[model samples]
Target: MRITRGLADIVIDSLCRGVFAGDCRRLSLRSCFPFLYDAECSKRSVVLGMVAGGDKTPHPDSPLIQRSKKEKWSQWSLRGGMQTLSEALESYIKDKGVEIHKDTPVEALERRADGRWQIKLPDGSVTADHMISAVPAAEMSRLLTPIAKPMASTLREMSASTVAVVNLEYDGEVLPVSGFGHLIPSFEDRAMLGIVYDSLAFPEHNRRSSSSTRLTVMLGGAWFESSVGDPDAVSKETLLSLASEAAATQLGVKEKPRRAIVTLNKSCIPQYTLGHWKRIDHLFSYIHQHSLPLSLIGASYQGVSVNDCIYNAKKAVQRLTGS
Candidate 1:
């Protein structure tokens, strides 16, 4: 069905900015929402495509897909925040004899003549039969420039958005509503992208009294550099002020927060703009053509969610193990 310009402006634009944190006009429907694009390509109708697609067989090895067959999927959070998940994974892997090196910055990556991957570190270098890069696109591009200039150049072209998270804890409940907060449309021209009701979703994670409320204000996305200026130069105090002002104006939150924290994540979210899929396809083709023992994973290439990363990582492992 053809979407009217009015509807597109009202809904599609808002959704694109909210989900991808980028402008819909600039983002590729094929890259950002492949399901919709695939449906249109194959069935000529998105609705029909979705129906046909759902009838297809699910991957046998996918635990998530299997779980969905028996029960509905639900959003969940760890008891001690997201860090708990990382810690748990670390513990489980440690038991399996995986040697994890923390705080060791990799200076460069070199492909040895023996077809092994050499990782240069501050102290020494380590060689491996295979290498999986999970770093951001820019960093990955920088590291791969010497070995794979063409692929690195392609990676360098991919853009990302910065986000500033301002966490505020008030003495008493301040939110006017009780759900997952709200997202501001790009048309709104607000500094804040959205606000997440942290305590409302996971009350157990609250460190303050039961009566208190915790809010996480998300600022900056595609408009960060243009509107807010340099992220590094922006002060935490300024961010806190912005959060407070947003809270007061939007949610009618006037009370001063007992505690506030500001965190600037530079280029945290990748923008899958037009031709993103083509770029990815080219990168994979290059890898295969060069017979490189390297694999790429993480938010830069595909899905950005934690579940997406885990699913992709599992698929990569299966491929490497010939499972």
Candidate 2:
């Protein structure tokens, strides 16, 4: 089978004509990832292209996709925060007699003569019968380099995008919209990639304050470094300022934020890029050839989202147990 190359190579007529009725040049379908228009669904990994970036997929130009019986649709969220899910999982695992190590970063991985895997940590090392890495491909490459240099090299070539999040609490409803939020198009040339109407999306978010609206403004993605500078180097204050300004302008609100929380997430989202499948195929081939007891999972290789990770984890566990 022939692999479709870059975003430019794919045609965009079928997918987004309604949004961009005429002169599609004004809007690039390549700007959106996993564009539903493609005809070859299998070629384009069933991935969340929006969060990662559009140019990441191998087949950006597949013809429009029809609603499939196989597709499941549901949006799930925890009451407190997304972190609540992790905390609950940690607690549940602990209750189930699983040893949960907190804050211990894995430094390296080595294979022992007995065929067991040794994991190097900050203070010492621990041996495990099997190992599964949920870390980003680049970080995994660093750990895998000692064991499989070629695989590590290929993994390192994988790219990821960083995001700076600015959380702001306003005195009142500052946004014109009353729903989840809005994603800005790249053609807008805006610093903010998207904005989430937290309070509106979830009423619980507003209970903390007296009818105040909370907005999570996300900036920096594929265009971050080019538009703003190094994501890590950019100060919280700067991000807050940019977010506030963008929010105010976009929402047409005059109320200044009562408070702001800025977070610079380095290498946050993986970029699928044009020919990502080839790299993945190579990495998997190496792992299978060596019969490595390592299973790669998470946003880097498969899908991105809490549910996606959970689904992938379950699949991995089944594969490992041969159930």
Candidate 3:
């Protein structure tokens, strides 16, 4: 597993603790921790292929993400984006010479007397000294029915929701912001959460040689359901209106987007509230006593960021491998 901070100025510091803290500090952080960062998410949002000065800074304190680096959002190409993230994971797996099964999903986990856990896939089962599960907590509870009661009970009490990503492509240059786009504060009470000037963030995307730049707008949490009832409608005009508003109010662009793509991820984000740590402690205790040799992982338990998911997964692997 690899840990990468997408935010520019941040490092692995002690930010999560502040949010987890239930005193005066936590009260102070309600607004600060979830800063409104309107940073660059695209390259075309800038001029002459130069990097925009947009600030993608996240709320200084996150309950799950580390706090040791500056918080500026950077442009990401599909290759650069996924490539940067996968590089470390691939390296670790390569060192161990493990081949991935990819699309084949696991159906069950059975622990044997020898202390190894067997993962049941569609066609067969693979047994390891212990297994790490990186699926979402809700899914894990559903899959591991024997202990599902407690897991489900705890998960239900926590708040979690999904986010929708709307991709809006245009044929012109976007007005430059500090780095990329910004996050919508919970207090804002707006349907759109934040946006990334995708083209301005990535140089390749704004290559004069290229025809158009694609912008990605994000509507997170409950906004998905509140904005539009139909997924198809949400993907279409719902995102377009928001993107158009930004372009007009922020960029002064009139030409309608040349193209658009909308991606909706159900259960995209996991919300961890006050009792997350204690609940996880108790949940893990139960798993340990049974010595089920099963590893459960995902954004649902530890965090919502990509880095958080990988970090927690690696931690599980460490304990499982005793490394």
Candidate 4:
């Protein structure tokens, strides 16, 4: 059950920091790794839980399980890009009579005396019997402050990490080695979090006319303020320079990129800091006590991965519809 300092550091750097974008000391194990936490709680030992609690027998009717038996798990990507998934979802919902209001930010949220939810937009307001909030924790907090101060306070306390993504494309392959990418630990004292070898992993995404290499460098997580300075003040040129330096030092890439792009995502990844589970429990208790129809979902409450969001969304719908 006990691990040496060396092994502990490796796990903290590779698993905790890689996934949560936060240090293991700050991240809540229960919130970030619920399965492992739950297993430890029930089995009284993490190792035992891992060995004994696994799904030993696959269900015969499960298509996914059966397919996995035949095909080994491998990395995959969409044809066009991640944006394609969003476009497809929008099209499907539009066909299903879902009216989407783009670029219309909600200014305020109010609970009507008739037990309905009213959302105030710039132009007008709309009311609904139930509401599912998928916004970030801080934004949700601002909207709920007038109605539920306590819940808003709790939500406001949840912190998020800003990330800068720098994409570089070279005319020819520049990487010395071929693999997914590498993650840098906090101990390395580097501003970069990791790098993704996009061209290698998803060759279909590359330009068909020419052989090119694409790389995505991720910068600034929990240490953004200390390492990279203000996310807003940092220029694209600086990020690109840093990305280039990182590539040159780590991957032996010295060639200038043919094309480059830098994007700053402010407060993108929610940090499930210590006591996150307790805070969420309190939020749910408050919602129950007030009989509020508001349901919270997304990276702030549960898991952060795309799969996690989809699964949670489905569960939320089932709960709301009594299915």
lDDT of each: 0.84, 0.69, 0.56, 0.84
lDDT of 2 by residue, 92-202 (tens): 999999976789999888899988999888889889999988999999989888889999898988777777888888886667778877666555643557777888777
User: By TM-score, how accurate is candidate 3?
Assistant: 0.67
RMSD of each: 2.3, 8.2, 11.4, 2.5
Model 2 vs truth, CA RMSD: 8.2
The reply for model 3, stretches above 4 Å from the true place, is 1-79, 87-96, 113-115, 156-159, 176-178, 186-189, 208-214, 230-238, 321-323
Each candidate's clash count: 0, 8, 48, 0
TM-score of each: 0.92, 0.78, 0.67, 0.93
Count residue pairs with overlapping backbones in model 1: 0
Alpha-carbon shift of residue 126 in model 2 (angstroms): 1.0
Off by over 4 Å in 2: 1-38, 41-74
After TM-score superposition, what is the CA distance of residue 303 in candidate 4 from its true location, in Å?
A: 0.6
270: Cα error in model 3, Å? 0.6
Supply the global lDDT for candidate 1: 0.84
- Winner on TM-score (1 vs 2): 1
- Candidates by TM-score, descending order: 4, 1, 2, 3
Which one wins by lDDT: 3 or 4? 4
lDDT (tens digit, per residue) of candidate 4 on 224-322? 888998887999899899999998898889999999999988998999999999999999999999899988899889888876786778778989999
Q: lDDT, candidate 1, residue 265?
A: 90
